[model samples]
Target: MTETLLILGAGQAGAQAVLSLRQQGFAGRLMLIGGEPFLPYQRPPLSKAFLSGALPRERLLIKPENFYRQADVECILDIPAVSLDTAERRLTLADDRQLPFDQLLLATGGRPRQLQCPGADHPRLHYLRTLGDVERLREHFLPGARLIVIGAGYIGLEVAAVAVKHGLKVQVLEAAPRVLARVTGAEVSDFFARVHAEAGVEIHCDTGVVGIDGGADTARVHTAAGDVMEADVVLAGIGLLPNVELAEAAGVACENGILVDDLARSSVPGILAAGDCSNHPSAIYGRRLRLESVQNAIEQAKTAAATMAGKHRPYTQVPWFWSDQYDLKLQTAGILQGHDRALVRGDPRSRSFAVFYLHENRLLAVDAINRPAEFIAARTLIPAGGRLDPARLTDESVAPQQFA
Candidate 1:
């Protein structure tokens, strides 16, 4: 008999798991379940082109309906898996139906964190995470309207770029000293700080909204620094909290997220975790990380599916991420933590440059700003553990080909 695979979330990770299983020649019965009522879709663009009216909802889908039917993948949409019975290897749905599985993958994903201040729950205040939320938020985002975004993180900043393009008044409140303070270095934070400010964005650093005042027609934001900004719409771009309650209640190890091993296996023998809902020990960075990027979901789900299909291999992939801010195309390769030096090979003011984050004596990561050559070169730079000389780095006359 073929094994039964029950995937708990139909987001990027869950959808990739089904695709990976088929690619790896797994002859299993696959059943994917999600709370959303649509087919699996790519989420990164939701905060970017989707909200900006550059892309339609149909283009966001990762796969077409015909692909699922041809793959024989059973999909249950608009239904959430409620409870898990570890001992019985079954899951109870909201309608009281039991789903029996030989193996299960938890890709429950995550939800956006909301502010709890006064008037936070007002109708004007919104948080964007799903396609439905994006559709709703886009309605209130009229051109030339005032938009107050709380948080200077990735989503918030991306939305600011769109609001600016539409000629909307944009004010972003960040509690940290710099934007993306914990993720990247001081240089990166400073770079974006300047980028947004130059684009007519009112970015308030070292400040946070203490209370929200939703007036009869406008929403007013009262900051901790005693600054008040009125807005026609409010967007909460705070971080995300993983949907680990189901895993934690089922006795799965839960840390910052569902604690998974190298193979994406949780504490439960038959249970596995992947994507935003997982905090896996990254062999590349030597620490546990929960990445909400499309790269992590696809790569980690592929590793998880391979392991579930009887293949034994450690999940290790070069960690990379990117963000699109206006005409700036930022491509990053490798994990850049614990870097002692940052070498700028190109010019930031020219808007075409690359910043190399070197750790100790080895190359850690490269943040290329519209420089595809440096970005591609650094992919091999970190994997080979190559040494980069700071003197040759800044000299644009010396090509990056020498490092190869």
Candidate 2:
């Protein structure tokens, strides 16, 4: 009997799973489903190039449309899977259609965290999560328009940079004491803060937005510090909440995201999850993490597909992420948590440097800004658990190979 595999969510992870399955010689039935109307596309570009109109919508697609037809993969678009019956091996779509499957993969990525404050429902208030979001926000990127951006994370900072390029006055409100506080170290955060400031982005750190008020034409952002900032458009890039309701409803263990093992297998047998929606143990970092990067999505999907194809393979890829703001390219590899020391290689003043985070003598992570060579070296060194000398790392004359 030919077994059928039904994949939920047609984002990067889901699309990669289909390709991986075929590559692994899984000739059984394959069906990829997504809530979005379009074919699986890249979401990272939506905030920058796509928003700035530098890249068209067609370029965001992961594969050509006919690739699905040629691969014999059925694509169900513009519809969402509302319920999952793990016991019965079935799924119910939003349109009340129930489909049976021999195996299931949940890649229902994530949704943008919406502002709960008043006036958040205003038409001018935007959250850039989908292609449609960028399209709507692009309409408001006129010259001299006021853009109040809440949060200073990658998404917020990227959007602010793009808005400034379009001649929009961008003001970033961050609740943390510094920009990129949650991800990067203090040195890297300060560097980015200075970079954005020099780029004409007014950053207000530790400023909590109490509420947003006003109507369609304009909005007033009220801060906890008794300040009201008016804006033509309000953009909130707080974070993302992983889509785990379907997994949770089907009795799958979830904590922040669907709990999966290194193989991307959930607690329930015959079911798996990946991408931003799955929390899995990282053999590399020795901790469980739910990564929201495309690198993690593709790697996890490949692991899941291999496992489904009767080839057991563990996912142990080192986590890496990148961000594009203004002309600066920030590439980060590995997790920086619990790092006690940080060594800076190169000068931040020149806008080309790498910050290497270490615990004792072991390399933990690296944040490379406009330094691709250093980033590549760190990616190799960190995963290999190479020893490093702090003095050598700080000296620019010392090559990365010396430490390895």
Candidate 3:
């Protein structure tokens, strides 16, 4: 009898798994389920190109409709998997439909973390996580509108950049001491704060929102610093909460995300988890990580698919990510956390440079600002985990290719 593999969540990982399982010659009864109505689409561009009117909605799809039909994969869309029974290997959809599987892949991804303050449920307040969310927010992106953004993370900053460019008066409120404090060093964060300031974005770090008072026309945001700011619209991008409730309900192990091994196998046999909803062990980092990036989703799904296809490929890909803001491209390779030292390679005053993160002289990560060559080189160097000369890293005369 042919095995049936059911994949939940039609985001990047689910869609990638569908394509990869076929590529790996699974030839099983493959089915992909998504809660959203549309096909699997890219979420990264939702705040940047898609929100700015530069890219159309059609271009966001991971794979066209014909690809699924041609590959003989079954797609159940717009219906969420409401419950899971690991013992029975069955999933129940929101519409009361039951489906059994020989193996399962959980890729439910994550949802935006909303503010807990009062009046947050007001229609004027927004969170950018889905296509519908962005579309709704875009309706209020009028020129001369007062837009108050809460959180200084990538999503908030990206929205601020686009709003400022669209002629809206934008203000960003971050509870942290500095913008991008959680991800980058002080130098990188300071540089971006300067960039946004010059671009007409008002950034208020060390400011915490206490409550929101929403009226028919505008909303007033009260901060902990004893100040209230009114805005025509409010957008929050605080963080993400992984979609692991279904797995947890079914007795699957979960912490920050669904627990999985390096090969993407979960605590339950014949079941795997990947993407933003999975916290898998990283052999290189020697710790478990739950990454919320497109790279992690794609690569981890490939590993999950390979395992289901009877292949023995371990997932040890050096994670990489990129963000675009006001003509600035920040490409990062590896995880910079826990690095003992950070070195700058070019002049930030010139608007192009790279920050190399080292731990005990070993190259751990690199944040390349408008520097693609170094970013590419860092992707290769990080996996090798080799020690490098600190003097040569900061030398502008030396090229990235020579680092290896």
- Highest-lDDT candidate: 3
TM-score of each: 0.96, 0.99, 0.99
Looking at model 1, the pairs that clash are none
Give the per-residue lDDT digits (tens) of candidate 3, residues 1-404.
Answer: 99999999999999999999999998879999999998899999999999999999999999999999999989999999999998899999999999999999999999999899888887789999999999999999999999999999999999999999999999999999999888888889999999999999999999999999968679999999999999999999999999999999899999999999999999999999999999988877889899999999999999999999989878999988999999999999889899999999998988899999999988888999999999999988887888899998898888889986
* Candidate 1 ranges beyond 4 A from true positions: none
Model 2 bad stretches (over 4 Å): none
| Better model by lDDT: candidate 1 vs candidate 3 | 3
Predictions in order: lDDT: 0.87, 0.92, 0.94
**Residues 1-404, candidate 2, lDDT per residue (tens digit)?**
98999989999999999999998999999999999998999999988898888998899999999999999999999999999998899999999989899989999999999888777787778998888888888888999999999999999999999988889999999999999999999999999899889989999999999888887789899998999999999899999999999999889999999999988999999899999999999877788999999999999999999888888889998899999988899999999999999988888999999999999778889999998888888888887886777898888888876766
Off by over 4 Å in 3: none
Model 3 lDDT, full chain set: 0.94
Q: What's the C-alpha lDDT at position 392 in model 2?
A: 85
- Report the Cα lDDT for residue 323, model 3: 92
